[model samples]
Target: MKEKIIEALKRIEQEFEVKICFAVEAGSRAWGTSSPDSDYDVRFIYVHKTDWYLSIDQKRDVIELPINNQLDLNGWDLRKALQLFKKSNPSLMEWLHSSIVYFQAFSLDGKMRELEDQIFQPRASLFHYLNMAKGNYRNCLQTAAINSKRYLNVIRPILACMWIERHNRFPPNEVQPLIEALIMEGEVKRELLTLIERKVTRDDHGFEVDFPIIHDFIEKEIRHLEEYANSLRGPSRDFTATLNELFRQVLEEVWSQS
Candidate 1:
Protein backbone atom coordinates (compact mmCIF):
# COMPACT_ATOMS: atom_id res chain seq x y z
CA MET A 1 0.00 0.00 0.00
CA LYS A 2 2.86 2.38 0.83
CA GLU A 3 4.52 1.60 -2.48
CA LYS A 4 1.25 2.15 -4.29
CA ILE A 5 0.80 5.50 -2.57
CA ILE A 6 4.33 6.54 -3.51
CA GLU A 7 3.72 5.59 -7.13
CA ALA A 8 0.52 7.60 -7.14
CA LEU A 9 2.40 10.61 -5.82
CA LYS A 10 5.10 10.17 -8.48
CA ARG A 11 2.43 10.03 -11.15
CA ILE A 12 0.89 13.21 -9.72
CA GLU A 13 4.26 14.99 -9.99
CA GLN A 14 4.60 13.96 -13.61
CA GLU A 15 1.01 14.70 -14.53
CA PHE A 16 0.95 18.09 -12.84
CA GLU A 17 4.60 19.10 -13.48
CA VAL A 18 5.17 19.67 -9.79
CA LYS A 19 7.63 18.47 -7.13
CA ILE A 20 6.08 16.79 -4.13
CA CYS A 21 7.90 18.09 -1.07
CA PHE A 22 5.91 16.19 1.55
CA ALA A 23 3.10 13.69 1.79
CA VAL A 24 1.38 11.79 4.57
CA GLU A 25 -1.61 9.71 5.50
CA ALA A 26 -4.61 11.53 6.94
CA GLY A 27 -8.14 10.78 8.29
CA SER A 28 -8.86 7.66 10.33
CA ARG A 29 -5.76 5.84 9.10
CA ALA A 30 -3.41 8.47 10.45
CA TRP A 31 -5.46 8.87 13.61
CA GLY A 32 -4.89 5.19 14.53
CA THR A 33 -8.53 4.12 14.50
CA SER A 34 -9.17 3.01 10.95
CA SER A 35 -11.42 0.06 10.33
CA PRO A 36 -10.26 -2.78 8.11
CA ASP A 37 -12.27 -1.30 5.26
CA SER A 38 -11.08 2.30 5.61
CA ASP A 39 -9.78 3.91 2.48
CA TYR A 40 -6.40 5.55 2.10
CA ASP A 41 -6.51 9.32 2.56
CA VAL A 42 -3.27 10.60 1.06
CA ARG A 43 -2.48 14.29 1.38
CA PHE A 44 0.56 16.09 0.13
CA ILE A 45 2.17 19.49 -0.46
CA TYR A 46 3.88 20.16 -3.75
CA VAL A 47 5.66 22.94 -5.63
CA HIS A 48 5.58 23.68 -9.31
CA LYS A 49 8.54 24.93 -11.34
CA THR A 50 9.77 28.50 -10.72
CA ASP A 51 8.03 29.86 -13.82
CA TRP A 52 4.70 28.46 -12.69
CA TYR A 53 4.54 31.02 -9.84
CA LEU A 54 5.68 34.07 -11.81
CA SER A 55 2.28 34.73 -13.37
CA ILE A 56 -0.29 37.21 -12.09
CA ASP A 57 -3.27 34.99 -12.81
CA GLN A 58 -4.80 33.14 -9.83
CA LYS A 59 -4.32 29.53 -10.74
CA ARG A 60 -5.90 26.70 -8.87
CA ASP A 61 -3.95 25.89 -5.71
CA VAL A 62 -5.32 22.44 -5.04
CA ILE A 63 -5.19 19.06 -6.82
CA GLU A 64 -7.87 16.48 -6.15
CA LEU A 65 -8.08 13.14 -7.84
CA PRO A 66 -11.18 11.06 -8.43
CA ILE A 67 -11.91 9.14 -5.27
CA ASN A 68 -12.18 5.39 -5.49
CA ASN A 69 -13.16 2.89 -2.85
CA GLN A 70 -9.51 2.31 -1.99
CA LEU A 71 -7.85 5.72 -2.35
CA ASP A 72 -8.60 9.41 -1.95
CA LEU A 73 -5.61 11.39 -3.16
CA ASN A 74 -5.20 15.16 -3.04
CA GLY A 75 -2.63 17.87 -2.43
CA TRP A 76 -2.00 21.55 -1.94
CA ASP A 77 0.42 23.73 -3.91
CA LEU A 78 3.34 24.98 -1.83
CA ARG A 79 2.18 28.58 -1.88
CA LYS A 80 -1.26 27.51 -0.70
CA ALA A 81 0.31 25.39 2.02
CA LEU A 82 2.56 28.20 3.27
CA GLN A 83 -0.31 30.63 3.29
CA LEU A 84 -2.30 28.21 5.44
CA PHE A 85 0.77 27.69 7.64
CA LYS A 86 0.84 31.42 8.30
CA LYS A 87 -2.76 31.31 9.45
CA SER A 88 -2.07 28.27 11.70
CA ASN A 89 -4.45 26.03 9.79
CA PRO A 90 -5.21 22.94 11.89
CA SER A 91 -5.41 20.60 8.90
CA LEU A 92 -1.98 21.69 7.69
CA MET A 93 -0.56 21.33 11.18
CA GLU A 94 -1.96 17.81 11.39
CA TRP A 95 -0.44 16.97 8.03
CA LEU A 96 2.98 18.07 9.21
CA HIS A 97 2.68 15.89 12.30
CA SER A 98 0.98 12.87 10.78
CA SER A 99 2.54 9.54 11.81
CA ILE A 100 2.38 8.01 8.33
CA VAL A 101 4.68 9.61 5.76
CA TYR A 102 4.81 8.47 2.14
CA PHE A 103 7.38 11.01 0.91
CA GLN A 104 9.38 14.03 2.04
CA ALA A 105 12.04 15.90 0.15
CA PHE A 106 14.00 19.14 0.48
CA SER A 107 13.64 20.91 3.85
CA LEU A 108 9.92 21.65 3.85
CA ASP A 109 9.17 19.46 6.86
CA GLY A 110 12.05 20.73 8.99
CA LYS A 111 11.42 24.35 8.09
CA MET A 112 7.75 24.06 8.98
CA ARG A 113 8.57 22.32 12.27
CA GLU A 114 10.82 25.22 13.23
CA LEU A 115 8.02 27.72 12.71
CA GLU A 116 5.30 25.67 14.40
CA ASP A 117 5.65 27.34 17.78
CA GLN A 118 5.70 30.82 16.33
CA ILE A 119 2.80 30.15 13.97
CA PHE A 120 0.50 28.17 16.25
CA GLN A 121 -2.74 29.94 17.11
CA PRO A 122 -4.40 28.21 20.06
CA ARG A 123 -7.71 30.01 19.60
CA ALA A 124 -7.99 29.05 15.96
CA SER A 125 -7.06 25.43 16.61
CA LEU A 126 -9.44 25.13 19.53
CA PHE A 127 -12.36 26.53 17.61
CA HIS A 128 -11.61 24.26 14.68
CA TYR A 129 -11.70 21.13 16.83
CA LEU A 130 -14.60 22.45 18.87
CA ASN A 131 -16.68 23.02 15.79
CA MET A 132 -15.81 19.57 14.44
CA ALA A 133 -17.01 17.97 17.65
CA LYS A 134 -20.21 20.00 17.73
CA GLY A 135 -21.07 19.37 14.11
CA ASN A 136 -20.42 15.62 14.26
CA TYR A 137 -22.40 15.26 17.47
CA ARG A 138 -25.33 17.27 16.12
CA ASN A 139 -25.37 15.52 12.77
CA CYS A 140 -24.61 11.89 13.57
CA LEU A 141 -24.98 11.09 17.26
CA GLN A 142 -28.49 12.40 17.98
CA THR A 143 -30.21 9.01 18.09
CA ALA A 144 -29.83 6.15 20.54
CA ALA A 145 -28.16 3.92 17.96
CA ILE A 146 -25.10 5.79 16.70
CA ASN A 147 -22.61 5.10 13.97
CA SER A 148 -19.34 4.09 15.63
CA LYS A 149 -17.26 6.05 13.16
CA ARG A 150 -19.33 9.17 13.77
CA TYR A 151 -18.87 8.72 17.51
CA LEU A 152 -15.12 8.58 16.99
CA ASN A 153 -15.24 11.64 14.78
CA VAL A 154 -16.77 13.60 17.61
CA ILE A 155 -14.58 12.08 20.33
CA ARG A 156 -11.27 12.69 18.59
CA PRO A 157 -11.91 16.39 18.09
CA ILE A 158 -13.22 16.76 21.62
CA LEU A 159 -10.06 15.10 22.87
CA ALA A 160 -7.98 17.41 20.70
CA CYS A 161 -9.70 20.39 22.28
CA MET A 162 -8.87 19.03 25.72
CA TRP A 163 -5.22 18.58 24.76
CA ILE A 164 -4.98 22.12 23.43
CA GLU A 165 -6.71 23.62 26.44
CA ARG A 166 -4.49 21.77 28.90
CA HIS A 167 -1.19 22.06 27.01
CA ASN A 168 -1.83 25.17 24.94
CA ARG A 169 -0.28 23.61 21.85
CA PHE A 170 -1.41 21.79 18.75
CA PRO A 171 -2.53 18.29 19.63
CA PRO A 172 -0.92 15.17 18.22
CA ASN A 173 -2.55 13.78 15.08
CA GLU A 174 -3.04 10.27 16.50
CA VAL A 175 -5.90 9.32 18.85
CA GLN A 176 -4.11 7.10 21.38
CA PRO A 177 -1.89 9.88 22.67
CA LEU A 178 -4.90 12.07 23.19
CA ILE A 179 -6.75 9.29 24.96
CA GLU A 180 -3.76 8.39 27.12
CA ALA A 181 -3.09 11.96 28.14
CA LEU A 182 -6.58 13.37 28.57
CA ILE A 183 -8.67 10.45 29.80
CA MET A 184 -8.10 9.04 33.22
CA GLU A 185 -8.31 5.36 34.19
CA GLY A 186 -12.06 5.06 34.61
CA GLU A 187 -15.27 3.89 32.94
CA VAL A 188 -14.95 6.63 30.29
CA LYS A 189 -11.50 5.47 29.31
CA ARG A 190 -12.56 1.83 29.29
CA GLU A 191 -15.57 2.53 27.12
CA LEU A 192 -13.57 4.64 24.67
CA LEU A 193 -10.86 2.02 24.35
CA THR A 194 -13.48 -0.66 23.73
CA LEU A 195 -15.06 1.45 21.01
CA ILE A 196 -11.70 2.06 19.38
CA GLU A 197 -10.88 -1.63 19.48
CA ARG A 198 -14.17 -2.48 17.78
CA LYS A 199 -13.67 0.32 15.28
CA VAL A 200 -10.24 -0.90 14.23
CA THR A 201 -10.97 -4.60 14.27
CA ARG A 202 -14.35 -4.61 12.57
CA ASP A 203 -16.38 -2.56 10.13
CA ASP A 204 -17.25 0.83 11.58
CA HIS A 205 -20.49 1.27 9.65
CA GLY A 206 -22.37 -0.84 12.15
CA PHE A 207 -24.30 1.11 14.75
CA GLU A 208 -23.84 0.62 18.47
CA VAL A 209 -27.08 0.61 20.40
CA ASP A 210 -25.97 2.81 23.28
CA PHE A 211 -22.89 4.52 24.69
CA PRO A 212 -24.33 6.65 27.43
CA ILE A 213 -21.00 7.10 29.17
CA ILE A 214 -19.26 8.29 26.03
CA HIS A 215 -22.21 10.49 25.11
CA ASP A 216 -22.15 12.16 28.49
CA PHE A 217 -18.42 12.76 28.18
CA ILE A 218 -18.84 14.25 24.73
CA GLU A 219 -21.63 16.60 25.79
CA LYS A 220 -19.80 17.91 28.87
CA GLU A 221 -16.56 18.42 26.95
CA ILE A 222 -18.35 20.20 24.13
CA ARG A 223 -19.91 22.70 26.52
CA HIS A 224 -16.69 23.20 28.49
CA LEU A 225 -14.54 23.49 25.37
CA GLU A 226 -16.90 25.98 23.80
CA GLU A 227 -16.44 28.29 26.78
CA TYR A 228 -12.70 27.65 26.93
CA ALA A 229 -12.16 28.17 23.23
CA ASN A 230 -14.07 31.45 23.34
CA SER A 231 -12.03 32.73 26.29
CA LEU A 232 -8.68 32.08 24.58
CA ARG A 233 -6.76 34.80 22.72
CA GLY A 234 -5.42 34.68 19.19
CA PRO A 235 -1.78 34.48 18.18
CA SER A 236 0.10 37.77 18.42
CA ARG A 237 3.07 37.00 16.18
CA ASP A 238 3.01 37.58 12.42
CA PHE A 239 4.90 34.92 10.46
CA THR A 240 4.27 36.11 6.91
CA ALA A 241 7.82 37.33 6.26
CA THR A 242 9.32 34.21 7.78
CA LEU A 243 7.07 31.89 5.78
CA ASN A 244 7.75 33.86 2.59
CA GLU A 245 11.49 33.52 3.09
CA LEU A 246 11.11 29.81 3.74
CA PHE A 247 9.04 29.49 0.57
CA ARG A 248 11.78 31.12 -1.47
CA GLN A 249 14.39 28.86 0.08
CA VAL A 250 12.34 25.78 -0.81
CA LEU A 251 11.90 26.97 -4.41
CA GLU A 252 15.64 27.45 -4.68
CA GLU A 253 16.34 24.11 -3.02
CA VAL A 254 13.87 22.14 -5.13
CA TRP A 255 14.47 23.85 -8.47
CA SER A 256 18.23 24.35 -8.16
CA GLN A 257 18.71 20.60 -8.19
CA SER A 258 16.11 20.03 -10.88
Candidate 2:
Protein backbone atom coordinates (compact mmCIF):
# COMPACT_ATOMS: atom_id res chain seq x y z
CA MET A 1 0.00 0.00 0.00
CA LYS A 2 2.83 2.39 0.89
CA GLU A 3 4.67 1.67 -2.35
CA LYS A 4 1.51 2.16 -4.37
CA ILE A 5 0.79 5.49 -2.72
CA ILE A 6 4.38 6.64 -3.26
CA GLU A 7 4.27 5.79 -6.97
CA ALA A 8 0.93 7.55 -7.31
CA LEU A 9 2.38 10.62 -5.58
CA LYS A 10 5.36 10.67 -7.93
CA ARG A 11 3.13 10.41 -10.99
CA ILE A 12 0.83 13.17 -9.84
CA GLU A 13 3.60 15.52 -8.72
CA GLN A 14 5.51 15.25 -12.01
CA GLU A 15 2.34 15.56 -14.07
CA PHE A 16 1.19 18.59 -12.09
CA GLU A 17 4.57 20.38 -11.80
CA VAL A 18 4.35 20.85 -8.03
CA LYS A 19 6.44 19.60 -5.12
CA ILE A 20 4.61 17.42 -2.64
CA CYS A 21 5.67 18.29 0.90
CA PHE A 22 3.71 15.41 2.43
CA ALA A 23 0.99 12.92 1.55
CA VAL A 24 -0.97 11.55 4.47
CA GLU A 25 -3.74 9.06 5.19
CA ALA A 26 -6.15 11.64 6.62
CA GLY A 27 -9.58 10.06 7.07
CA SER A 28 -10.80 6.90 8.83
CA ARG A 29 -7.62 4.95 8.03
CA ALA A 30 -5.41 7.46 9.82
CA TRP A 31 -7.79 7.61 12.78
CA GLY A 32 -7.04 3.96 13.81
CA THR A 33 -10.55 2.53 13.36
CA SER A 34 -10.81 1.89 9.65
CA SER A 35 -12.91 -1.00 8.43
CA PRO A 36 -11.69 -3.42 5.76
CA ASP A 37 -13.18 -1.26 3.02
CA SER A 38 -12.38 2.29 4.13
CA ASP A 39 -10.98 4.60 1.49
CA TYR A 40 -7.44 5.90 1.67
CA ASP A 41 -8.02 9.67 1.90
CA VAL A 42 -4.69 10.99 0.67
CA ARG A 43 -4.26 14.58 1.85
CA PHE A 44 -1.24 16.64 0.94
CA ILE A 45 0.25 20.14 0.59
CA TYR A 46 2.27 21.25 -2.39
CA VAL A 47 4.04 24.30 -3.79
CA HIS A 48 4.72 25.68 -7.24
CA LYS A 49 7.57 27.93 -8.36
CA THR A 50 7.36 31.71 -7.78
CA ASP A 51 5.60 32.28 -11.11
CA TRP A 52 2.46 30.36 -10.01
CA TYR A 53 1.49 33.17 -7.64
CA LEU A 54 2.96 36.29 -9.29
CA SER A 55 -0.28 37.13 -11.05
CA ILE A 56 -3.53 38.98 -10.53
CA ASP A 57 -5.28 36.24 -12.50
CA GLN A 58 -7.00 33.56 -10.38
CA LYS A 59 -4.80 30.62 -9.43
CA ARG A 60 -5.66 26.96 -9.10
CA ASP A 61 -5.24 26.40 -5.39
CA VAL A 62 -6.43 22.80 -5.08
CA ILE A 63 -5.52 19.46 -6.70
CA GLU A 64 -8.22 16.85 -7.04
CA LEU A 65 -7.38 13.44 -8.49
CA PRO A 66 -9.76 10.97 -10.00
CA ILE A 67 -11.19 8.67 -7.30
CA ASN A 68 -9.50 5.29 -7.32
CA ASN A 69 -10.22 1.99 -5.65
CA GLN A 70 -9.92 2.41 -1.89
CA LEU A 71 -7.73 5.44 -2.46
CA ASP A 72 -8.41 9.09 -3.25
CA LEU A 73 -5.40 11.41 -3.61
CA ASN A 74 -5.67 15.20 -3.50
CA GLY A 75 -3.74 18.27 -2.33
CA TRP A 76 -3.92 21.99 -1.61
CA ASP A 77 -1.57 24.58 -3.06
CA LEU A 78 0.54 25.99 -0.18
CA ARG A 79 -0.51 29.60 -0.76
CA LYS A 80 -4.13 28.48 -1.01
CA ALA A 81 -3.68 26.62 2.25
CA LEU A 82 -2.14 29.70 3.85
CA GLN A 83 -5.05 31.91 2.82
CA LEU A 84 -7.52 29.40 4.27
CA PHE A 85 -5.30 29.04 7.32
CA LYS A 86 -5.80 32.75 7.89
CA LYS A 87 -9.54 32.05 7.98
CA SER A 88 -9.03 29.06 10.31
CA ASN A 89 -10.75 26.41 8.19
CA PRO A 90 -11.44 23.20 10.17
CA SER A 91 -10.64 20.77 7.31
CA LEU A 92 -7.22 22.37 6.85
CA MET A 93 -6.58 22.14 10.59
CA GLU A 94 -7.39 18.40 10.51
CA TRP A 95 -5.17 17.87 7.49
CA LEU A 96 -2.20 19.17 9.50
CA HIS A 97 -2.96 16.64 12.24
CA SER A 98 -3.39 13.56 10.01
CA SER A 99 -1.64 10.57 11.59
CA ILE A 100 -0.24 8.85 8.48
CA VAL A 101 2.24 10.91 6.50
CA TYR A 102 3.60 9.17 3.36
CA PHE A 103 5.93 11.95 2.22
CA GLN A 104 7.89 14.81 3.82
CA ALA A 105 10.49 17.30 2.70
CA PHE A 106 12.36 20.34 4.05
CA SER A 107 10.45 20.50 7.36
CA LEU A 108 7.55 22.30 5.70
CA ASP A 109 4.87 20.03 7.21
CA GLY A 110 6.54 20.31 10.59
CA LYS A 111 5.99 24.06 10.50
CA MET A 112 2.29 23.64 9.75
CA ARG A 113 1.90 21.22 12.68
CA GLU A 114 3.44 23.74 15.04
CA LEU A 115 1.00 26.47 14.02
CA GLU A 116 -2.23 24.45 14.55
CA ASP A 117 -3.56 25.94 17.79
CA GLN A 118 -2.44 29.42 16.81
CA ILE A 119 -4.67 29.24 13.73
CA PHE A 120 -7.66 27.22 14.93
CA GLN A 121 -10.83 29.36 14.61
CA PRO A 122 -13.52 28.38 17.13
CA ARG A 123 -16.56 30.29 15.86
CA ALA A 124 -15.84 29.56 12.22
CA SER A 125 -15.02 25.97 13.01
CA LEU A 126 -18.18 25.53 15.05
CA PHE A 127 -20.23 26.98 12.24
CA HIS A 128 -18.30 24.80 9.82
CA TYR A 129 -19.10 21.62 11.71
CA LEU A 130 -22.67 22.72 12.30
CA ASN A 131 -23.22 23.47 8.64
CA MET A 132 -21.61 20.19 7.61
CA ALA A 133 -23.89 18.32 10.01
CA LYS A 134 -26.94 20.12 8.71
CA GLY A 135 -26.10 19.37 5.08
CA ASN A 136 -25.22 15.72 5.66
CA TYR A 137 -28.30 15.11 7.80
CA ARG A 138 -30.60 16.65 5.27
CA ASN A 139 -29.07 14.92 2.28
CA CYS A 140 -28.12 11.58 3.75
CA LEU A 141 -30.80 10.88 6.37
CA GLN A 142 -33.56 11.88 4.00
CA THR A 143 -32.68 9.03 1.65
CA ALA A 144 -31.47 6.66 4.39
CA ALA A 145 -34.80 4.89 4.36
CA ILE A 146 -33.58 3.28 1.13
CA ASN A 147 -29.92 3.18 2.25
CA SER A 148 -27.98 3.12 5.53
CA LYS A 149 -24.51 4.57 4.88
CA ARG A 150 -26.07 7.97 5.33
CA TYR A 151 -26.68 7.37 9.03
CA LEU A 152 -22.96 7.20 9.82
CA ASN A 153 -22.46 10.28 7.67
CA VAL A 154 -24.78 12.44 9.79
CA ILE A 155 -23.61 11.03 13.13
CA ARG A 156 -19.96 12.12 12.89
CA PRO A 157 -20.48 15.89 12.70
CA ILE A 158 -23.01 15.80 15.54
CA LEU A 159 -20.42 14.09 17.70
CA ALA A 160 -17.91 16.73 16.60
CA CYS A 161 -20.26 19.42 17.88
CA MET A 162 -20.43 17.68 21.24
CA TRP A 163 -16.65 17.55 21.37
CA ILE A 164 -16.30 21.28 20.67
CA GLU A 165 -18.89 22.17 23.30
CA ARG A 166 -17.17 20.23 26.07
CA HIS A 167 -13.49 20.58 25.19
CA ASN A 168 -13.78 24.27 24.24
CA ARG A 169 -11.40 23.45 21.44
CA PHE A 170 -11.35 22.93 17.68
CA PRO A 171 -11.96 19.17 18.10
CA PRO A 172 -9.65 16.33 17.09
CA ASN A 173 -8.91 15.11 13.58
CA GLU A 174 -10.09 11.59 14.36
CA VAL A 175 -13.67 10.94 15.41
CA GLN A 176 -12.85 8.04 17.77
CA PRO A 177 -10.33 10.09 19.74
CA LEU A 178 -12.85 12.84 20.26
CA ILE A 179 -15.37 10.28 21.49
CA GLU A 180 -12.99 8.43 23.81
CA ALA A 181 -11.28 11.50 25.25
CA LEU A 182 -14.29 13.78 25.55
CA ILE A 183 -17.30 11.62 26.33
CA MET A 184 -17.13 9.65 29.59
CA GLU A 185 -19.23 7.01 31.30
CA GLY A 186 -22.75 8.25 30.72
CA GLU A 187 -25.96 7.48 28.86
CA VAL A 188 -25.04 9.94 26.13
CA LYS A 189 -21.74 8.20 25.54
CA ARG A 190 -23.10 4.66 25.52
CA GLU A 191 -26.10 5.43 23.37
CA LEU A 192 -24.10 7.32 20.79
CA LEU A 193 -21.40 4.67 20.56
CA THR A 194 -23.95 1.91 20.19
CA LEU A 195 -25.62 3.81 17.40
CA ILE A 196 -22.34 4.33 15.61
CA GLU A 197 -21.25 0.71 15.95
CA ARG A 198 -24.58 -0.68 14.83
CA LYS A 199 -24.72 1.64 11.88
CA VAL A 200 -21.18 0.77 10.86
CA THR A 201 -21.85 -2.96 11.05
CA ARG A 202 -25.01 -2.67 9.04
CA ASP A 203 -23.24 -0.62 6.42
CA ASP A 204 -20.42 -3.15 6.19
CA HIS A 205 -22.98 -5.91 5.72
CA GLY A 206 -24.79 -3.80 3.11
CA PHE A 207 -28.01 -3.54 4.99
CA GLU A 208 -31.07 -2.28 3.16
CA VAL A 209 -32.70 0.09 5.63
CA ASP A 210 -32.54 1.37 9.22
CA PHE A 211 -34.60 0.76 12.30
CA PRO A 212 -37.01 3.67 12.77
CA ILE A 213 -36.02 3.99 16.42
CA ILE A 214 -32.34 4.35 15.49
CA HIS A 215 -33.13 6.86 12.74
CA ASP A 216 -35.35 8.90 15.02
CA PHE A 217 -32.74 8.90 17.78
CA ILE A 218 -30.06 10.13 15.40
CA GLU A 219 -32.34 12.94 14.18
CA LYS A 220 -33.21 13.97 17.73
CA GLU A 221 -29.56 13.89 18.74
CA ILE A 222 -28.52 15.98 15.74
CA ARG A 223 -31.08 18.64 16.60
CA HIS A 224 -30.20 18.59 20.29
CA LEU A 225 -26.47 18.88 19.64
CA GLU A 226 -26.87 21.58 16.99
CA GLU A 227 -28.74 23.66 19.55
CA TYR A 228 -26.08 22.89 22.15
CA ALA A 229 -23.22 23.97 19.85
CA ASN A 230 -25.05 27.10 18.69
CA SER A 231 -25.45 28.30 22.30
CA LEU A 232 -21.77 27.93 23.27
CA ARG A 233 -19.16 30.58 22.34
CA GLY A 234 -15.85 29.10 23.45
CA PRO A 235 -12.30 30.47 23.31
CA SER A 236 -11.27 28.10 20.54
CA ARG A 237 -11.03 30.34 17.48
CA ASP A 238 -8.75 33.26 18.47
CA PHE A 239 -5.57 33.18 16.33
CA THR A 240 -2.32 34.23 18.00
CA ALA A 241 -0.51 36.80 15.85
CA THR A 242 2.87 35.36 16.86
CA LEU A 243 1.85 32.00 15.42
CA ASN A 244 0.67 33.64 12.23
CA GLU A 245 4.08 35.26 11.89
CA LEU A 246 5.70 31.88 12.34
CA PHE A 247 3.51 30.49 9.55
CA ARG A 248 4.52 33.36 7.26
CA GLN A 249 8.17 32.69 8.04
CA VAL A 250 7.74 29.03 7.11
CA LEU A 251 6.02 29.95 3.84
CA GLU A 252 8.75 32.47 3.07
CA GLU A 253 11.47 29.88 3.57
CA VAL A 254 9.77 27.37 1.29
CA TRP A 255 8.69 29.86 -1.35
CA SER A 256 12.10 31.59 -1.42
CA GLN A 257 13.83 28.30 -2.15
CA SER A 258 11.29 27.35 -4.83
lDDT of 2 by residue, 1-258 (tens): 889889998987789887787888877666544666778889888877657667999977888988888889889987777777767777777777777878887676677667665665566677787788778777864663534345555656666677766765666666666667765656555555555564445443555333565457567766776677567564554455755565466556666766
TM-score of 2: 0.79
lDDT of 1 by residue, 1-258 (tens): 888888899999999999999899988999999887889999999999989999999999999999876999989999999999888899999999898998889999898998888788999988888998889988774665565676788889999889989888888988877898899958888878777887898744564534678878988888898888889887777888888899999999999989
Model 1 clashing-pair count: 0
Superposed by TM-score, candidate 2 places the C-alpha of residue 163 at a distance from the truth, in angstroms, of 1.6
Superposed on all Cα atoms, the candidates' RMSDs to the truth, in angstroms, are 1.7, 3.7
Global local distance difference test of model 2: 0.69
Q: What is the lDDT of residue 67 in candidate 1?
A: 84
Backbone clashes under 3 angstroms, per model: 0, 2
In terms of TM-score, which candidate is strongest?
1
Q: State residue 91's C-alpha deviation in candidate 1, in Å.
A: 0.9
My TM-score estimates for the predictions, one after another, are: 0.95, 0.79
